[model samples]
Each structure stands twice: as structure tokens, then as C-alpha cells.
Target: MTKPQGFVSKDRNLHVCKAEAAASASPADEQPLLGEPEQPKFLGIELVTLKKIIPLGLMFFCILFNYIILRDTKAVLSVTAQGSSAEIIPFSKTWVYLPMAIGFMLLYRKLANFLSKKALFYTVIVPFIAFFGAFGFVLYPLSNYIHPQEFADKLLNVLGPRFLGPCAILRIWSICLFYIMDELWGSVVIFVLFWGFATQITTVDDAKKFYLLFGLGANIALIFSGRTVKYFSMMRKILGRGVDGWAISLKAMMSIVVVMGLAICGLYWWVNTSVPLPTRSKKKEKLKMGIRRGA
Candidate 1:
């Protein structure tokens, strides 16, 4: 007979049997508990951090570059209009600025890949020399012979309305050539080297912070450029007039550009050589691992 319904089976040893079952279940419970939790990893660096800094740099570069362009244009235009009845066209012969636009885009991509610091240094210096050297040796001599009155009359007569005739084309082409040789090449070189240095030294995050700082430096440059133009004007007052005065202004602008280039280059070289590469992040390692696994 069943001894009362809730009574334990003493003879069957039910308590010991239940204890053994609990012990067996304990190891199964411990398996999930013993597994490790995932750890957080740092993100890898990227080049986009330079975005803010670049615009600032560009602003300054644009200011200085534009001032030089404007100053040169005014001087050249004046010389071309000298003793002429034709209104000195503000940008009649300044179409050369277009070539500079093209050259800047092209050289920017080229200079970005340069890994060698020395190569970059030379890349910057050589362009400056070639540019100003040609201006000094070739263009300066030609300027002495330029009769603005005659040149303007001939150009306006030939250009007529189409603005694509022989003289117009030549004038524009000449302007483009000058811009490329004198300004665009050097500007791209400087920008590439500066950003390259920035990218190399800082992690993506730090770059975001310092890029703005660099931009502030660039803004200062723009402001400085305006002041420099005034100084050039003052110098022109003291130095006399005509082709020689313009030449001095051009030379002064080039000298400043050259100095700035050299200074930035020196700074870049120092930063490039001195700063240690950023430490790799776990996320980068994981990504590498994933790639390997996928492969």
C-alpha cells in the first residue's frame, strides 16, 4: 500500500537521488557563466579628419594666391593699357588663371602619394625656382618691350566679339601658362606636404582637433596677405613707377611665397621625421582578421 501520498520513500533513498541530479546540472549551468565577455575596441584612423584644416589652409592660400593674381593682373593690365584709348579690360588677358585651376587639381592628386620627405622637399623648391626663374629671365625682358597702347588696340581689333581669335587666344594661353608655372604648382606642393604630415602624425581623432588649429593659422595667413598687399603699395610709392615698380611687386610676392613654402616644408619634414606613427587599434586588427577570414 502507498504510505500517505506526500511521504518520502525512505527505503528508495529519494533525497540522495535528488542531490545527485542537482550536482549534475551545476556543471551545465557553469559552462555559459565561464565564457568571456567581449571587450570594446578603438576605431581605426582615417584621413577625413583633415577636412576642417584643409578649408582653412585653402582660405589663406586662396587669399595670398588671389592677391598675387590681382596685383599682377593690375600691373600687367596697366602696362598693356598705357597710352591706349581702349578701356583697359579688367581681365581681358587674365584667362590664364584657368590653367592654374586645372594644374592645382592635377598636381594635388600627384603630390598626395609621395612618401619620401626629401622628394616632397625638392618637389616644392624646384617649382618655385623654375617659376620665378622664367619670370625673371624671360617674362621680365619681354615686359620691357610691351607697348600697352599698341597691344590693346591690336588685341581689341582682332578679338572683336568672338573673343577666340589669334590675339585673344594667345593672351589667354599666356596667362594660363604664367599661372601654372608661378603659382599653382607651388601651392599644390605645399598643401600636399602639409596635409600629408598632418595625416601621418595624428590619429583620426586628434587630427580633427588640430586641423582646426591649422586652419586658424591659415586664416592668419589670409589676413597677413592683405597687409602684405598694402605694404607692396607703399613700396611702390617709394620705389617709383612703370614696369620696374610692377616687377618689384611681383618679386616681393614671389619671395614671400617662397619663404612660406620653405618654412612649411621645414616644418613638415620635422613633423614627419619626429612624430611616431599612431598605434594600431583593435578594430583595425579585427578588420584585418575579418579580411583574412573572408579571403
Candidate 2:
């Protein structure tokens, strides 16, 4: 009889079978069963993730740059204002800034109930820009008339030298107002608005990866704003005497602030426009699915 097809003799079986040999092989000895997936990335961040983060980072940079500038400028304006000293800072922080912060928190809670995020941002931000611009251009020019010098002097006499700090704050009330608003900028913009928006849009995993990168923009702002502050501080020297250089510097700083504020608004608008609503919804949905699967 002829040998049957698909039959293996005992001699053939004694040798290593091809299928079994392949199965026994290590992964390193074989090619991948499927092609590896390709991801477009820059500096380890996926392109899509970078697209979402860069505009947000620019927004953060502008916000932080304004904050740094205002912080330095406010200290100089408050401490050097007529009758005021560095001592006013403690009183301002304890009494004025604290109360304003508390009031803002309460107001924010109320606003959150009804207003959209963009409306809330503009509402909070525009007033700051307006006030700073007014202070630099309109209000500071009238400081001699606006400040209650005689009243502060009378109060100082009655309250004695012990009350100089409070009296000083009363005298330079416009400067005090500037001080408080600058303090609020740091707290409200960075903590409440920017971070809140960031966390809302980004998934947890993305936040973990990119929040540090976002923070790096703020750190870089320190360098840029510091150099700006230094330049403005030395403007009187740079521009020479009898030129009202400090006033010029104030205008320049405030103008930069307005520009940066508008840039922040533009970046905020870009983020909303560029990152589609569907992408955010999908990210949230995917995050929810991940949570469910993990559970």
C-alpha cells in the first residue's frame, strides 16, 4: 500500500515539530506578531496633548507675568507713598487683603451658580485691568487731592505714633487699594481661574503629565517679568532727571499689563475654539470608562 497523506511516522514525530519549535521560541528570536503603533509626539508629549497644552501654557505665562509685575510694582507704590512705610504691609495683609479675599470667595461661590466660566473669567479679569489702568493713568495723577492727608494727620495725633501704620494706609488709600487688588490677582487668577480651568479640561492622566509643564511657563515668567521690573525701576536713571520717568515707567508697565491681559483673553478664546467641545466630552467619557474598568 502507498503511504497516506497527512500522516506522520514515529520517526518524524521523534524530531522537533515545526509548530512546537516556533511556540517554544523566545520573543526576542521572532518578529512582532503585529506592527507597533505609531504616535506623533514632540519632546515625549503627544502632538494632540501638546496642541491642547501650549495655548493654556501661554495663558498661564501671561497671567503669571502680570502677577509678578504687579507684585513688585505694588510693593514699591505702597511702601514709598506719602506717609506710608513697609509697616503698612502687615496691616494691609491682615485687615484689608484678608477681608477682600473672603468677600471674593463668597462672591465667587454665588457667581459659580449662574455664570459660565468664560463670563466669570472676563468679569473677574476686566475689572482688574480697569483698576490698574485707572490707577496708573487717571487716579495716581490726582493722588494729592484724593489722599486724605489732613484726616490721617489728625487721626495720627489722636491715636498717637502707635497708629502710624494704619494712618498711613488711610492716607494713601488709592495705593492701598492697588496693593489689595495686586494681592487678589495672585490668589484668584492663579488658584481659582487658571488651575480650575486647567483641571476641568484635562483628564487626570494628562494633568499628571502636563501640569508640571504648565508650571514651567510660570517659572519662565519670573525671569521675563523680573527683567521688566528692573528696567522700569531704573527708568529714572535711564531716562535722566526732570522727565517724570517714574510716571512714564508706570504707564509703560500698566500698558504692558493691559496688553498681557488681552493676550490672556485671546489665549483663553483660542483654547476654547481650538480644543473642540467633542474632544473634551470624549476625554471625560474615556476617563469615566477607565474608572469603571479599574473598579
Candidate 3:
């Protein structure tokens, strides 16, 4: 040691290096973390709250819309006419579906972007008005056009040997679209809206939760909507059949869908408006805040 006056002993050199490494590792010795920390609790709470409220609201709206459509249309395919003269009630309606499907798909994509959650809810109001208006303005008068005898005759002709299988399949497919649109208006539209919203929202985990909650609500709606058709037919006798009863129920159901659509659109708007851009600085800040809050 005397010979090397400027040099530290090996033990002392090693000790100094180890002390520096430990100090570097200690956050207390360094500057505070710069960004917000992960807010697991806050996120968990928000997710849970949304999961409960949104699904329940959707389910109620679904039930109402199903009741309306079922009451009005009865959703039955009756073969009323005999032999070559037979007809089906839904014949013309099937032709209308191809166009409606195209329109619906286009509207869905556009509205998913243009409408806020609030506006989407209001958009559904159109359908409500449309449904009742449709019944009074179109279906009520058309009900007179629904001749059971003629329908049967048309059906028999369509199902005769040559056209039987293919014609039946086409009719069934048309019926499927009719039922799908009627019963699933809210669920389907909302699901599409949510898909757009999920892409907008940066939080992948939150999107996952929201999707699952809404998906469950939709499945439940599908099951209930199918079962309710029978009950609705029976209830219609007591509910009355004149324009007023039909109009009122149809309006009520349309209102439900419209309102629910608005809510979903509103939520999308809120999420888009509220969630900040996920830049590196913001993410770091979020991380720091999250850690501090956790501590």
C-alpha cells in the first residue's frame, strides 16, 4: 500500500464499486419516476361498473323491441292457399330484404363513425317512428292484402315438385333475415357500434371486458326474443288489434331500440372524448402515476 500511494486496497476498491451499484438500484437515491403508473384498481372499477350497467340496459331495450316486432308481424310464415294457387305471406317482404340488407350494412358502417353515443340513441328513434309509421302507413293497409287463401295457393305452387327444395330454402333464408333484423336490431347495431368504439379506445383490456359484457347481453336477447314470439301472439289478443294498440306497442319497442342505440353512441363519444392519445410521454406519465397511486 505504501508503495502504491495513489491506489486503493483491493477490498476497499471492491467495496466502493458495490456501494455505487446499490445506490444506483435504490429509487430513493434517484429522481422520481416520470410517468403515470398503472391504475389497476381504477381500471378494474371502471370496467366492472360498465359491465353491469351497459348489459342490463341493453337487455331491457332488447325485450321491448322484440315485443313490438312480435306483436305487429307475428313473425309467422303461413301457407294459406291450396295447390297451384298457394301463396306465402312473406313473399314480397323477401324481395325487400336484399335491398334492406345492403342499406343496413352501409348505415351501420357510416353511423359507427358519424354518430356519437347520444346521436346513435336518437338514431334508433327513427326506427321507432318508422316502425309505428310503417305499421299505420304500410302494414295496416297491407294487412288487408294478406289473403290467407291466396297465400296458401301461392305456397302450394311454389312448393310443387320442381320448385320444392330450392324454393323452400330461399323462403327460409328470407324468413331468417326477417327474424334476425326484427329481434336483433338493438343487439346487432350496438355490437357494430362497439366494434368501432373498441378500435378507438386504446385500452385493449377494457375493450375485451366491454365486448364480453355486450356479447353476453346479445346472446341473452337472442334467446329471449325467440321465446317471446309465442307469448306475444297470445298477449296480442288481450293487447287489442286495432291501429292504436299496434301503433303504441310498435312505438314503444322502437323507442327502446332508439334510446339504447343513443346510449351506446353516447358511450362511444364519451370514450373517444375522454381517453387521451397514447403517446410515449403520456404512457410514461400514466405509468408513474399508476405506481405512485399503487404505493
**All candidates: TM-score:** 0.52, 0.78, 0.44
* TM-score for candidate 3: 0.44
Q: Whose lDDT is higher: candidate 1's or candidate 2's?
A: 2
Worst 10 residues of 1 by lDDT: 286-295
Alpha-carbon shift of residue 85 in model 3 (angstroms)? 11
Question: After best superposition, candidate 3 residue 43: deviation in angstroms?
Answer: 8.6
Candidate 1 lDDT, 1-295, residue by residue in tens: 7686556557357888888887888532653345675333235223343443344355346434544544554445434533421222334335554555555555544553543456755665566555654564566447536424356557767668554333433443333345445444435444544455456556676755556665566566557677877788678778744547756776676666555555545555554454445665435322221322321
In model 2, state the lDDT of residue 215: 68
Q: After best superposition, candidate 1 residue 59: deviation in angstroms?
A: 14
Residue-wise lDDT of candidate 2 within 49-128, one digit each (tens)? Answer: 77778888998999999999999998889878888888999999998899898788777766655777789888988899
Best by TM-score: 2
Tell me how far the alpha carbon of residue 261 in candidate 1 is from the true structure, in angstroms, after superposition. 1.8
TM-score of 2: 0.78
User: Sorted on lDDT, highest at the top, how do the candidates line up?
Assistant: 2, 1, 3
lDDT (C-alpha, whole model) for all candidates: 0.51, 0.83, 0.47
Most accurate candidate by lDDT: 2
Model 2 poorest 10 in a row by lDDT: 286-295
Model 1 lDDT on a 0 to 1 scale: 0.51
